[model samples]
Target: MFGVAGRISPGPIGFDVTMIAVDQPTVARHGLTIVADHTLGDAPDLDLVIVPGGITDAVERDDRVLAWLRDRARTPTIASVCTGAFVLAEAGLLTDQRVTTHWDDVDALRERFPALDVVDGPRWVRSGHVFTSAGISAGIDLALHLVGVLGGPDLAVETAHRMDYAWTPTIPEAPEGPQRGT
Candidate 1:
């Protein structure tokens, strides 16, 4: 997810991206060892903070990560991809805001954070400075949207074209009512 966001920037968007983690030598769920470029304590105050979702149960339990998220939420534009919304919700950041997570986790998110207005099917949804995307591929869509927000529609389109990605400028409305099996 960070890779997607990072790639979008410093091209036409002109954003300086950084990868930070709560700890160094971070091992991702897929067993990828991510040597974080910055630790939470060492990261500069950010204009944007992106939380990429994976292993939500583990992340939601990390008080230190939640604390950092809570602090950063006050200033930067915070975003979450997939189950990362759970992390933001755990940090008390998603209360009463419309959000979406991966389709598979939407019910869990709503059950866990009843205060959150959890929407189900948009590729991504934005409420104020916080944005949440549905799943993995949707993160790229959200990143493109952010580029549109920060840069401009033309730049976003250009960036998309440069990457050979078919970017959708507008997200369709999610269907209303309980999803199947809910």
Candidate 2:
């Protein structure tokens, strides 16, 4: 809801979010099969890509998915929700970068990807074009931050207001490295 529906001030603060999958009739970790708007093969070019976390073992090892993420490495922004950071790290996109994931997966992510400087407290962390969130709800905060960056702070505030979310609009600083926006 950080896009068109979030427009309260009406100043061009809208993003066209699309759901893409490596294959159709994709089943989530909870066994909920979802029909995506596009598959990787025919997906249109996007300015931002947000990968949601789950039981991501299969997708993390899929060559097609990795290749697609690598190809989209130059996209303005690439973000992850919770364990999705593992997939990005697997694709070699988060080397030497500070990132975060779900609280429960923090140690595992740190162990699996030694190259990443995984921090534990931040709801979300941003290093250059890559953004990673702590867990499910943190993704919403990150998306709102993205809206603030892409659109404007006012729009982000309006979105939070409309959603009745207690959005602080403040981003936590990474332990090290530059936090650049898209």
Candidate 3:
């Protein structure tokens, strides 16, 4: 399965692997299972690709995974969590498309990837085939959105309500999070 790099904590000088399981209460309630991997290089045929945020490092620029993501986009729907949007941005997938990312990464992400039409707000955002979220916890929100979109609003709502999470908005929310960002 394709996965994004992540860290549990962002600190003064360093951090640890924040790679987390792509689990959603709603998804789980539906008997879903999401595996965790360090990179997206393994899956050759993916129905969907998900990237999550963390530190900005060499891996983010890894041509191997980037190329893999680029190539995979032709078949499966692609998505990101938080700053993972940066990965897709670098791969040149966000061009001329409206997308959302973790509030903290918005400015720099926008400046770094001018082609992307980045918007502010919401715990999660979906533009066309590319889905993005606010932050770590927001990943769950993004997943629910996908469930809603792919499974139907009723399913989405049921999933959200089942998970005890709030429903996503049709429009995006204003960005809000930590003090530091792009």
Candidates' lDDT values, in order? 0.77, 0.82, 0.58
Q: Measure candidate 1: CA RMSD.
A: 7.8
Top candidate on lDDT is: 2
Every model: Cα RMSD to truth: 7.8, 4.1, 13.4
Query: Which numbered prediction scores highest in TM-score against the true structure?
Result: 2
The residue-level lDDT of candidate 3 at 90 comes to 77
Clashing pairs in 1: none
What is the TM-score of each predicted model, taking all chains together? Answer: 0.85, 0.89, 0.65
Per-residue accuracy of model 3 over 6-62 as CA lDDT, tens digit each: 111122211122232322221222455555443343443545567767764554777
lDDT of 2 by residue, 70-114 (tens): 999988788999999999998888898999999999999989989
The TM-score of candidate 2 is 0.89
Indicate whether candidate 1 or candidate 3 has the larger lDDT: 1
Off by over 4 Å in 3: 1-41, 168-182
Ranking by lDDT: 2, 1, 3
